[model samples]
Target: MLIQILLILGFVLVFAITWRRFGQNVITFREASLWSFLWLSGVAFTLYPGLTERLASFFGVGRGVDLILYLAVAIQFFLIFKLFILNEQSERKITNLVEREALSHLNEDEPASANRPSNYESNG
Candidate 1:
């Protein structure tokens, strides 16, 4: 009973954070919805752990704990992959911005002297 209560409280906290993130536009509506669904599913599983056993059996897993562990590992890998993709996208955006800025400066009406090597570069 105590465990169930704690689980519910944890779900409530997650729900609150999800709502706040959505309200602040930190995440899209679709992401908020997905998070809410996941939290509710967690609450369901906590309230009825037997359901996991049944699910595990259906999936040919030996135990509920094993199934959960597998899921957690898969989720971790997926998140890591997503983070890698996002990092790549960010790098591309930054590179494009730098290139654009450099091109714009080249097109500006600067004197030839402005294009001279920097003092440090000349010294080197």
Candidate 2:
């Protein structure tokens, strides 16, 4: 009973944080909604573990704990993939910005005539 209470408290705290983040504009509404759903689901499962067992059997999983572990791993992998994609995109944008800034600086340091074609013909 104490553990269940603790788990519920933890889930509520996390749910509050999710909403707070959304309120502070640190996270989007969609993200907050998803997180809220997850935390609420956690609370539900903690309050009634039998639900998980029923779900597990329904899904052909041998045990409720096993189902939770499988889901946790899957969610972790999905989030990791999302982070990887975001990191790659950020790197690409940073590289492009750096290249552009370098080229602009180079142009600024050079004389205007340096970028133009020469009009004089070469004598044979």
- Number of the top TM-score candidate: 2
Residue-level lDDT tens digits of model 2 in 6-41: 999999999999999999999999999999999999
- For candidate 1, lDDT tens digit of each residue in 34-68? 98998998898998999999999999999987998
- Residue pairs whose backbone atoms clash in candidate 2: none
State the C-alpha lDDT per candidate.
0.88, 0.90
RMSD of 2: 7.2
